[model samples]
Target: MKTSLKRFFAGVAAAAMAVGGLALGATSAQAAGPVASTQTGSLTVKAANGTTGHTLKAYLVAAYNSDYQAASDGSLNFDTFKYVVTKDNGTKSNDESAVKAALTDAGVKASASGSASSAAEEGLRQLTGQSAGTPFGYTDGTATASAAERKFADALAKKLTATDSTKWTPSNVQDLTPGDGKFTADLNPEGLYLVVDTYAQKDGSKSTQSVPMLVGTKFANAAITTQPAGVGEVDMKNVTVPVHKEVVTDNTGKAANNTPSYNIGDTVYFHLSTTIPDYSGYAADPTLSDPTGKTIRQLNLDDEFEAGKFTGTKVVSVKDATTAIGDQQGVLENGKDYDVTGEDTDTVTVDLKRLVNGADGAKTGWKTGDVIDVIVSGVLSADATTTDKANTDAADKTGADSNGNSNKVTLNYSNNPKDNSQQNKVPGDTVNVYSFNLNVHKVNQDNNPLGGAEFKIVDKADEATPLQFTVSGSTYTHAKKDTDGAIETLKSGADGSIAVKGLKAGTYVVTETKAPAGFFQGALPSYTVTIAEHYTNDKTNTTRTSTKSGDDWLDTLTYSNTPDNYGLVTKDATSPSTWTVKNVKSITQLPKTGAAGIAFFSVIGVAVVALAALFAVRARKASRLA
Candidate 1:
């Protein structure tokens, strides 16, 4: 029996060893398989403004371990985890009730289990694959408990060191330092997780995990400035006017001095000084008169020196007489009424009709110290009046001056018949009068009048369109030139044309009366049309030039004349009525020659071809031998 029992025991022992070996092999195989993916779990703790640094560290470690387990398994469920937090200096802390309270306020539930170890164990049991009976023995070896705890501790240390002493404390919980404490844990799971160990001191000092508690994924930062919706409107009243140059002269005699001439619809500005004490009140009045008795139409204060006060400066527009008042008058006397003598003659004339027809007509004749209205306009014409001769003979006749001295015939008039006596006439004042001198003479190269020539003023170049001239109280007319370049009559139309009258042959210039409106008159040309002696009788042959042969006979002559269609000239003397012909030569009768170096180059090219052939033969022989 003893032997049988021994054998039985040995067999049992052998079987047990076999079973243990099988289990060991299976465990080894499981460990060699792919590691399971991990998830992230977060634990956030908040404490009062002033909490002990050691206490904050302890809380962070405990919270990290709890979340890591809860995320690993499903059974363990603990909000807060207890720990014995220690600083690098070995300073240790017990239960951190302030940290626990802060965590509770931050949405963390304190564990009723109470003990740090128990809370940690229970939290671990809350996650999957993590229980007291699990493969990891409820310690969450697969989770990041140890790493997370270390991270949380380091963050807590940084937080406590960076706290500001004043505005923050454990109780008041104000002035919390940003990122003072932080915690982060990397898990081997599909999701992310984080554990934040944060604390505040009673004195506003704070300590948190060094790294921010991260869970799941990260989000992008927010934008700063945004684009505007629409553009702003511009106000013209607030805009400034651009400055421009203007010409201000004494009289219309220098009208050409108006550099920038005014157009019909141009807006012009004027500067005027007033003797009036308070010119500010006149700004609102369109018709403000100056001290010189000149009226300003559309008068306005350019700008105020000291608000609502005028510095005697005014602006006015240039337009027709009725539009701008006081523009036609001269300056007025200080503290006095309008004065006709002091008024601007130009502006007064424009406003004359208005003054004469209105109540002011009785005071038409101006003097000093009278309140008179003046209109300002830029339409002052330099050539306001002009004169023309009624008869050429009368116009050509020389006249004697008042002193009986012989002078050239000229036209003269009293500029202002109303003031014929020239009572207030001044050199600078504008004058209205007829032409002073006929100034009829030939135009020279310098545009000056030439002597000893009577300009044959014609209406048209066609001889049939002869011009009529009044001479010595009689009218003289000329006719057009015939095919022979001679006129038919000197009194009336003949040979289907008009008579050609006699005139002094010389250069003459034709000019128009007044330049069309809106156009400036250009300077006249120097040279004018020449009326030769021949043109008086034969208008068509006016510009003809004759060349005589040995016998003084007109053999072959050439004529160059304007208005070319009037007549023709014969080239032969025997038949002076018709033209002759002549023969010309061909162009190919000229010379030709060969290039010098080109022939030599051609010969060299032939020699180069021969040499190339010899070399090719030698090269072929050498190849065959090789």
Candidate 2:
């Protein structure tokens, strides 16, 4: 009878292996004998290197009575067989009455005649066929779980976790550590088991979670089966979706730069991107609007800017740049596939639920490995904070920590496919935009301060267009021009200082348009000022370095003035590069009328007599020679 039982399950085990599951088979060479009740085996699980730090639990779902057989084509098969449920107290209670009651509780009918109905046996077969590779009926050919598979899995979970929780207690549990890489469950009776990752949370880190796996404790022969003999080993698989953000060079978002500069009121383009991982194991909800629903899974992108520093926030487009088909369909549609909350505000969020599952039963063009891009733009408003350093680009020495506007973006994704309510957040790198100021001072050759000098500044890149500024007394602040009209000239203050604020990093030409009253206009060369930020690996001359929270980048600030003769002046010994323009007083004392005029005429008459004597001498010398 035991030999017949083993032969009956050979076909069933083969079916399971056909769809990526390992089949349970006898390890002993005595394959033709009646199976012993003391038969036992071991199961081993191997996962990716970095994914091993977690807790794994195994629960016995059914007890198989026989080994699996492999065909000549290397396919597994199990014969028709009967499986018994173990006692809830983690022991083998083979009593017929108790077995019948447990089977009844699991919606399976058991007969005293030792034969189950066809319907009941089919239901049990589905449970035993669960595979480690295709959890939730998600196979390589299927994009998601079918309706029948979802119903069966959900029903099984509810039954296993009912008031009788002990009925499904884990048979073995292991807490794996980093670099361990594998887990083993030994001394298990011949049975099919379900293994689950209890600590599958990938929060703010690179490690991703694994889905539930099914393993058979009883192993097959090495020659007959492809899997490892005596140890049913399965490789745990996972998929991760990492995100990246940057201030790009243009609206196309092809170029990436973490540190960029912009003039006040200039449009700054931002690019946010991430790849879509496999969502076949994830469950979909009936109510798309309810994120907290029992079955809804979520993946969102949250972005924030420095308060009041940006305006006209616009989500230019969100598309899947991986394939041309995805680009044509816009993978995720606004108001249908995702909802943009907090638009035009400092904080904006893109909620992506319907993008994975279809919206209104419509399929999405998105698929695994699709590269998603979110393009956004905003104007660098005048509300941005400005700084003046004791020295140019010395933000670390005596000024605010950052003299630039900044924004950050992060990805909130469904890390665990089994648990829809759980999420893990991974932050992208922070991006910065820098602007600078140019200071001018009017002085005399004696270095005395002279007020009421006027000047205009223009960017060397676009000389035809003069920069507009709003003046408060003698201070100049950059203002966006509505029309291409002439801009106002800025004058020096009583302290011989004029500051032009809110300019982007570039070379600028400063020209003096008017001189101080009653002073001869000094020949002032076109002063060249350059403002820029540079990155380096060296420790010396670095303005910003790594932080305790994992921000590690080296950079320095550079502000310089050409024609180092007058040199840059630091106001109050520290702040703003001030260029000093020197002037001289005009001559006013005229020559006296009588004395000066008579002296001038007497000198001319002396010069005329000397010329006549020279000419007569030359003529007499020529006649003698002739």
Candidate 3:
């Protein structure tokens, strides 16, 4: 296993040819092979309690073989990992038959099914035009694989197993021990190597560990930007695994009665949470007055959301996991405590210079399971979509059709012990703010839609102030109560249908603010809708107003109706939930303007005839007397 530091690295011509087309990539630069050098730096595996790297071996994946440049694209950069993970998609099984055939043709005994792995290797070499038994690990540029091997990079997955084939310089290999997180290793010039910490247990088994990658030339004071410190250094660069944050209206367990759904004119309360870094070498300050201290120095977290989805003005509350509702004392003030910035106020940066500082005690620092909660008070806007990456077009917004509107939020925080620059930060997962919608339709006795019907929606049963609504991307959206814009008035659409969207579950009154033209206002009274829709725990249903998450039961709605002037009206099922007014006119008493209304005309006619007869008789009598 001993390798010459100069020969293994300097053996430019001795190393085997790389996969030209696939895993090696179609890029000519990658195909050209590693650029070797003689520079070396100290690499260490850092663990919570300072566990040694044990059996971890650093496999040289690529090499520039030159002096290390600060910003130069190192062969082992993030892009290389991406290519290996995403692009060089090939399965070792693909070439299994071909390899076995080639091995059989070459009179070699091997099997891809595990009977004899060497059989598959020999077959690969035979097909790829390499020496019969070219070692599976990185060797001097001597072995060669066929162009087809690049197409099936994953076919070599079996060959790439085992750490014995590592191409480490003799000087860089160091023995790792527990409680000794740091191990110094000298590396050759410009080359990229995959260093895995294989911790060997007393039982003779090995385990892998997580550690950061440090790219420094001389190993002086903080050479490159992405440093987790010797203490915080673990894992790859620019390639971060984000732990998605949670967006909840209320995490107070219903003591706050936060509703997940928002009315058009209701201010939405959003709470965001991100986990704290877990560094094991820390002591909890025994005194409750002091804060907890850890290995971290400067902590910075930048949270961002879609611009228009949230109002420009925000009332933000910050608190750590240490607070309880009864105490209600852990609320930290913004600006005075943390430097908050972002033109639209959709983004906030919390500078935890003093917060995460371990100097104070066990009182104010972060730890495992400890969360930093950021409560942002913003009104859901007219232009909202589930994937807040972009705004929805007005034509695309529909009440029932509205895909759940959401706010896009991301978290980028410092990963290094001391380095707080953007370069040294790890990106957390994106959290989504979700809200639902409701569609409404106005129908006749036949349950057919009619236009010109005006209605009003109010949180209270009185239907006092008409809920203001606006249309965006063809969808009707309501705003919060305190919003400055004009609220939307409900009027039947061209198709005799209207929707009150972006509404949280609550009881609301739908009043016939204005009846449709050509139709007398039906005796049907206003419809009272009670909708309670939000995330609720099953047991907390009694204490809260909302239904369980995924429960469709909004508050019950009651509508009052009276017979129209024509007759008594009855209800029939028009839609799953439609109100159709059926009028059965069978009048027992004549209307004031009906048959009784003409009786006066009949009397007038009789009076006119009687008067004519009297005139005639008087005339006759006068003539006779004359």
Candidate 4:
């Protein structure tokens, strides 16, 4: 198998005697016997050379003429198939006696019982596998081999059962050679074949086992389809699982998908994806191929989603990334290729499994550059209503909070490091949906803080009753939440500020029911307090900002009280942070102390009596004159 180019060329005439092999330069398809028109592919690792325990090896077996018979439970059984070999002239023979006579008449070594054909015959039987006589027996009533296959199996057993000195002269098969972190093979597609690969830490050890076990079922890596004629094409695209999880929100109804401001019970549309390990040059590693060391068996993905906030069912898809439109294979069924074996309310884990093809008996490996996208249709729980920062650091909770929520997606696999298992994880960005808080500040025209002020908040347009709150330590919680009660009073703190928590976007009204000690009506005027999504130019500036998305919204809602009026304090138009408020000034003044004052006094006189007497005198004189 390790013949050099020179030796291959020099002995072309002699090597042509091989029943399955063709001339070194032969390019055309054979007509007499099934040509090993094989094209090879290598399993490679990305780790650097001389790295510890990162070695690789490959195993190949042909599944020719043997159809994989599947069971009701998705298990495999090969249905009985006749040993029919297609000739170059399109003539096929299934009868063992007829096949022997035909090959003899054609002047060829039809029977593979020859000493030189021993290796091939042995290799073929190993590929067919067993059933009745061994644990991996091929025929189990559901799947059994024909007479020709039995003979083939007997021939292959020679290699496995042959004595140490007579085991066809060697115990090793030439592995794919390494080239720039990759390996290549040109396989002759004579009969259907399977390719399996493994790796180990290649630090010059002639023998070492690859980690996590690479022993796989014979049917697992078989050729997927009937091999195509001409040179086979194998394209491997290099792509990694993108680490930056981008979650753009498309909220419905009043749902909030943005970070730190979400409403409870809202659905968040989240998606995460991952990459398949490149198994390009794995065959060359001795650790994986060494009959004495551990070998790679299968590649699996371990992804667990947070359970606290992401609730309900989920959607997962396997996609081929090489195409622009994202060509997708059929959706995988749960308990088929994956299982949620031990899942609960707070944790869910899906393990991608390795399975065999029921049709071709080909074992499965992930396609290169292929990624899996999981559509997590998660809903925020009632716990989202809390004002506490998100439990982002908690490895247990999966709920969305003020700090946002992220999915800790992880990938667990084997063979890349050869000696032990390895893993790589990518974190999705947090989605934040947050509520608002209000701080009502009371001040005077001079910007002086004044306490002892009382106010009532109501739905301005509807004049609905203000919500009531009961005091508990430093907290004032909502008490009676009806629509027609007396407006609950809110008193300013010593600093003239009243903190209102847990509010949403809408318009509210704050009416001063009682003012500080010396106010005119002992009350200040009412003003509309709009708490919508208005951006803020500066934190200290009371005026709202209206810039763009992502800009600061309304924060502090400051109010000022005076003798007969009350209004909000705003930042100076020229200076963003300078607080300012406007109200009419009141001072002592002499009442119309001029002509208007004198006339008003003359007419008065407790003075309605004087006016009535004058009117009576004038009436008597007028009557006498008449």
lDDT of 2 by residue, 1-626 (tens): 01111111222232243322321332122133322223455666665534534666655555544544555655433442234444435444322232233445444442322233222233444433333234334542123533332333334433445576333334333332334567766635555555566554444344346555445564433334554222255555455576766667678776654346567778888788777766666667736665565367667888788889988887777777775444355545687667788778988888777676565743455567677788788888777756544123554331123656777777877666656667767776566666667788777657778898777788899887778887777767787887233256888889888877778778887777677788655333356788765532212212223412111122555577665222222233354366666665631121223443344455568889999999999999999999
By TM-score, how accurate is candidate 4? 0.39
lDDT of each: 0.22, 0.56, 0.38, 0.35
Scored by lDDT, model 2 comes in at: 0.56
Could you tell me how far off, in angstroms, the CA of residue 57 lies in candidate 2 after the best superposition?
Answer: 1.4
TM-score of each: 0.15, 0.68, 0.42, 0.39
lDDT of model 1, residue 530:
40
RMSD to native, candidate 3: 21.7
The candidate that wins on TM-score is: 2
Pitting candidate 3 against candidate 4, the one with the higher lDDT is: 3
Q: How high is the lDDT of residue 382 in model 4? A: 34
Summed backbone clashes in each candidate are: 97, 17, 62, 67
Question: For model 1, how does the per-residue alpha-carbon lDDT over 1-626 read when each residue is reduced to its tens digit?
Answer: 01121111111111111222223333232233222222232222222222333131211222121121221333212222112211222232322432333233333343634434333222222222111221111112111222222222223333443445311121111121223333222222222122223322223222211222222211001120211111010000000111111123322211212122221112222211111111110111123333432222111111111111111222232222122234344432222222222122222111221221122322223311122222222321112111111122322122211111110101111111111111111111111111111122222223232222222334334434433333321123221232223322122111111112222223333222222222222221122234321100111111112411001101111211232111111133432111211111111111112221333345567889999999999999999999
Clash number for candidate 1: 97
Task: For model 4, state the Cα shift of residue 143 in Å.
Answer: 16
RMSD for all candidates, in order, please.
Answer: 42.7, 10.2, 21.7, 17.0
lDDT of 4 by residue, 184-227 (tens): 44322222212223433243321122221111111222433332
CA lDDT, candidate 4, residue 265: 41
lDDT order of candidates, top first: 2, 3, 4, 1
- lDDT at residue 480 of model 1 (Cα atoms): 22
Q: Once model 3 is optimally superposed onto the true structure by TM-score, how far is the C-alpha of residue 529 displaced, in angstroms?
A: 3.9
